[model samples]
Target: MTQRVPHVLVVGGGYVGLYTAYGLRRAARKGRVRVTVVDPRSAMTYQPFLSEAAAGSIEPRHVVVPLRTVLSGCDVITGRVTGLDHGRRTATITPTEGAAYDVGYDHVVLALGSVSRTLPIPGLAENAIGFHQVEEAIALGNQVIDRLDVAASQRDSTLRTAALTFVVVGAGYAGVEAFAELEDMARDATRHYPTIEPSDLRWVLVEASDRILPEVSDSLGRYALAQLERRALEVRLDTRLVSCVDGHVVLTDGTELDADTIVWTAGVRAHPDLVGTGLQLDTLGRVVCEPTLAVAGCRHAWAAGDNAAVPDLTGEDGALCSPSAQHAVRQAKVLARNILRAIDAEPLQSYRHRHVGSVASLGLHRGVAELYGVRVKGWPAWLLHRSYHMSRIPTFNRKLRVVLDWTMAMFFRREVSSLGSLQRPAEEFRRAASSTAPRAS
Candidate 1:
């Protein structure tokens, strides 16, 4: 008699999906279960290191883990999970450059991550960029450097000032770190341009809330605000961006400016696929899951990471776990273990881990951290930030590469060249071909 191997379909190859699939690969090899990981992206991005990559502290390639390289024993599908029917135990998959199809599974893990939440502010969607993915980080670096090029070459003061001005919205870890890192890079690069002065570049951070870095204590947040202000950055609190029409910014506080660069990092909501999954969700549209990380009203279905609202046992109140990389990574471990137990008909354990403190890097040799009730600021915090994230960056290959990048950076100046043209490689060729073509008779 032949044994039947269970099929588990894991959605979204981000943190949770990658880790879960990686963990189950051994079991999959032994024929206990067959695992398939589905995502639109072929690689899992380590988002914590995105800001550093943008700042040239670490190479972008080192921050993302290729799914096929890491998950050796599992099937890695480069496709999007468009719809889920838990009752029917099937998922609708739409592959890039292929026909849509359904995949059957005995168990399903919905690790679909979140997307940026944007408001209806005028001209936002058309004008601003996001800071979530590797491509965006790369584009941001190119954009900043290209802006500097424009500032250096343009004799028009209005256009030059607009080119030099950079605006970053939201002051969370992503917002603050991105703003600081890019500004630091731009400031450093100014030495090479005789026409561009360091003081000529204007970096502004705007947050609608009264405070920044709300994950940290109020005092620490105040300290970060002061540090940024010391660098001559304009920190706008209690203000809203009313419009950004044609790069002309109008704030609620009657402030107006023209900036060629605008970055949005306000917040994120769960992937909209949750609504179509027909799963129970909280008010915020995150899947409601039990402590064991199982979907609230379904068997053979589980969820974790940013998409699931798991109860925070550490909070001691009715609070749910905060959507963060810390919780997502930890929950993936627990989620993998429980799935194995379920296959073996063993008892499952609950996911309960206290929230650790937060850390943020403000450019090279500067950071702020609150860890285990101990607050550290300045250079020490920056070192700790790098060390902690380096330790958490996934594979040994990537870890070694990141260390090599840091070690090499110590001996050489950071690369600040603008490769923005890579975003549109065919433009030059198209222009040349058009110019050489014969006119219509």
Candidate 2:
């Protein structure tokens, strides 16, 4: 008689899902276990390099790893897991088109990552864009360049000032890097426009907290503040974006400015889809997990990354692991191994790792890093930032491409041209079709 093979369904294709499947690739290739990954996006983005990609320091394609290419041994489904019934070991998938369907699995990994945490600030949803995905980053880059074009050609001083101003809300890693990198890119871009100067551009970084880069040390944060101010960029700490209606920005500090670009990088919340899973979630809506990275009290269910509240064995009691790539990547290895061990009837090992320090880039040739109790800043930190992320981003193919991009960038200038037509690809066709339409007499 033939034995039935266990099917492992991995939800979400971010760091956790990708690395977990990659870790289990050998077992999958040997027919020991069947693995399937499902997500809305077919590619997994290396978020740390997004700022560089937006700033044209790296090609956008190089920052994203196509799941089918990396997880060749696993089934890749481009859809969302709309519902989960662990009691029946089934998940409902809703594809981009067609009807929804259910798939049965012996084991499931809930790796649903986080989404941008937004507030109810008036006109925010309509006016600002989030900096959490590859598409958003690319659009933002194009928007900045397009604004430069608008600023250079506008006749009215108020309209020109509005077009030249850029605002970023939230000063976390995403916001700070985006703020600095985009500013640097725009400053360099002014050289191409004879009508625009570096001084003509206005960059603003708004944070509700009292300091920027809260992930790093206070000293490093202060240094980052100094660096940004030196570049003539505005840093507003302990301030909130009160409103941004029609490109008119009103801040909590009573300062108002006209800005055509507004970026929201506040923070992230656990994926909202967890409610449909019927799994136990914490107060913050994250799935509750045991030390072994298994869903608490559930059979053959596991979770990690931003959506799982896994106890941090290395931290003080009652503390859960933070949602960061460093922890997510490390947690995935353990999660994969434990799943294989469960199939073999072996004891599962607990997940535990001490928190390492943080690193962040402040545009080209400048950064801040704290590694193993050693603090570094400036060019050394920048190099460390690039080197660390380079070693961490998945796949030799992507790594090689990224290296080539940097190699080419060393001898050539970054591309500043904006392809704004990408935002409206059918506009030209629609216009041409309308022009040639037969007149009704």
Candidate 3:
């Protein structure tokens, strides 16, 4: 008689989905299980390196892992999971250009990651862009450099000022790192532009909270704030963006400014698709999971990453793990092991690992880090920041490529060219089509 292999279907190919599939590959080879990963994108982005990619320090190609290549032993589907009926153990997946279909699974892993959480601020949806995806990071670099070109060429003061001003909302890790990296890049590129000076470029960091880098220690956050202030960046704490109508920014603190660029890195919440899954979720829409990373009251379901509200055994009372890469990567290991144990009739273990630390790169050779309760700042922290993330990025091939990128960068000046035209490839063709139309009487 032939043996049956348990099919494990994983949703969303972000950090958690990639790692979960990666962990299960070896087990699948042993004929214990069959793993399949489904996501809208065919590649998984190493989000930790996105800021550097935007700053032109690393090539954008090296920051993503092709799901099929990494998960060779497993089934990889480039599609979105629309509906998940867990009671029937079936998931409905829709491809880019086809009808939705359902697939059955013995065990399902809910690793669907978070999306940008935005409020109903005016002109936000139309004007501002989020900084979560690799494409956004790449486009941000082009947009900033392109703005410099416009500012330098424009003769009008208002036009130049608007082109040169850059506003960044949210002071968390993503917000701070993106602002710092792009600001540094702009500062470096100013030497090439005869009409533009570094002093003329306005960089503003707005945060509604009292301090920046809230994930780190108070002292470290203060240190980071001082460092940014030293660079002449307007750090407006306890302030909110009241309106950005017609590219004119009005702040609650009565500060008004005209800017061409606004990057939103405010925050992210769990994927809303979970709301349709009929699973137990917290008020925030995250799937409620036990300490062992299993969906509570679901026998064959598991959850992790930003979409899961797993109890934080190591933190304060009734605290859930923060939706950070550190927790997601670590939880993937435990979740994968618990799945295998469940299949083999072994007892499942709880996910109780404490967070090691967090490191942030504030442009080149500038950063702040808190590791194992020991705080570090400046160049050493910067080195630690690069080294730590380099080690965490999956696959030796990607790691080697990243190291080579760093090695080549040491002997060369930064590249500051803009490829913003790539975002609108058909613009010229459309203009040509419109110009050749028949004339009216």
- Candidate 2: lDDT over CA atoms? 0.95
Candidate 3: tens digits of C-alpha lDDT, residues 23-131: 9999988888999999999999998888899989999999999999999899999898899898899999998878999999999999988999998999888788899
Clashes of each: 0, 0, 0
| Residue pair clashes in candidate 2 | none
Which ten residues in a row are the worst by lDDT in model 2?
350-359
Candidates in order, TM-scores: namely 0.99, 0.99, 0.97
Model 3 lDDT-worst window of ten: 241-250
lDDT of each: 0.93, 0.95, 0.93
> Measured by C-alpha RMSD in angstroms, how accurate is candidate 3?
1.4
Q: Write the per-residue lDDT of candidate 2 for residues 156-202, one digit (tens) a residue.
A: 99999999999999999999999999999999999999999999999
Question: Candidate 3's error at 415, in angstroms?
Answer: 1.0
Candidates ranked by TM-score: 2, 1, 3
lDDT of 1 by residue, 1-441 (tens): 997889999998999999888889888998889999999899999998999899888899999999999999899999888888888999999999789999999989999999998999888998999999999999999899899998889999999999999999998999999999999999999998899989999998999999999989998899999999999999999988999989999998999999999999998999998899988998989999999999998999999999999999988778799999999999998998899999899999999999889999988899999999899999999999999999998899999999999999999989999889998999999999999999989
Error of model 3, residue 294, in angstroms: 0.4
